[model samples]
Target: MTCRVLLADDHAVIRAGVRAMIQDIDDFTIVGEAEDGKETVEMARELEPDIILLDISMKKVSGLEALQALNRHSPECKVLILSMHTGPEVVLEALQKGAHGYLLKDAAAFELRLALEAVRRGDRYLSSAIVQPVIEQAVSKVNSNAEHTLTQRQLEILRLITRGESTRSIANGLGLSVKTVEAHRAQIMKRLQIHDVPGLVLYAVREGIISPDD
Candidate 1:
């Protein structure tokens, strides 16, 4: 089956390059091109493409924002993040926000094809260049004694925290007071023995508490 794809990027040249790459594949076809995240979301809802090649730094809505929107509004469509960013934080955030794959812009043309195929098969894909770094970050251990001691509510709070939600936002979304949220956060950190947000994020990913595939 031909996979219909929407290209979303701020750079025309990058879109053009992607178009050229897709044209070489027999089972992939470009359905539309979007210059920004807002347009990408809009077109995604309308076109319902099988996959989207999304850039992370688009103007207005931004690629991450678009991914979140698509996760809610057009969930059936898979998104493959195409970005220059190599940071574990960015890659994890994209996956957590519902990107099917993350492909670095500096990756070889063949890697893009591999990413698309992986996403098409309903598998999460991370660029080979970034896999080791992300794995290394995830190697931090959660406190063994505390691992099974967390309440479900504490796990919920931890999930939000790792997803980059501010305490106030988490409180508002969870319908709790800011002070209550802060207290819960403190408890979570204490139980996990995780001193920092990065550590918390890595722990969350490693423990399967929150995932891109979710």
Candidate 2:
């Protein structure tokens, strides 16, 4: 099946280049383009593409803002953030806000297709050039000393959560009650001081508890 894509960037040249690259791929079709964040959000809502290739900086609205808007308005459409920013904060923020992948602007053309395929399979992707450092930095910032706080059971539950398992599925897999699983999740969140599921997933990735692709 061909995946419908929306290319959103402030630079027309970048959009054109991306379009050329994607046009060569049999499984992807460029359905629309947006020059700024506001337009990106509007087009995303209208087009409802299978994937959105989004830039971080844009006029009128920022990509982060647009990402949040898309999550609220069109949660079914996956978002892959294409940006120049390599800072862990930016990467983590995008992931936490529901981005399916993060690609650096300088990544090779081949990596774009790889990212698309990975995200299309419901897996997360980070550009090869930045993944290691990004994870290291993110984990350090989240408190390197805190890893010991989680018990083995909590770690197992956290991994299941990051893998997108439903609460009941997790309980069944672990042979635990739903209430027991939920209680474990709550303790995991409280122990880590991470409130949202995405935040927990991010922490799991950064701490090497779960692969983004898992």
Among these predictions, the greatest lDDT belongs to 2
* Residues 1-214, model 1: lDDT tens digits: 8999999999999999989998998799999999999999999999999999999999999999999999899999999999999987788778767787889998777888888987887656788788767745555443534454679999999888765566777899999999999999889888877766656766776777877333
In model 2, the runs with Cα more than 4 Å from the true position are: 143-214
TM-score of each: 0.68, 0.74
Worst 10 residues of 1 by lDDT: 139-148
RMSD per candidate (Å) reads 10.8, 4.7
lDDT of 2 by residue, 37-104 (tens): 89988898899899999999999999999999999999999999999999887888898888988998
After superposing candidate 1, which stretches have Cα over 4 Å from the reference? 141-214
lDDT of 2: 0.86
**How high is the CA lDDT of each candidate model?**
0.84, 0.86
Error of 2 at 77 (Å): 1.2
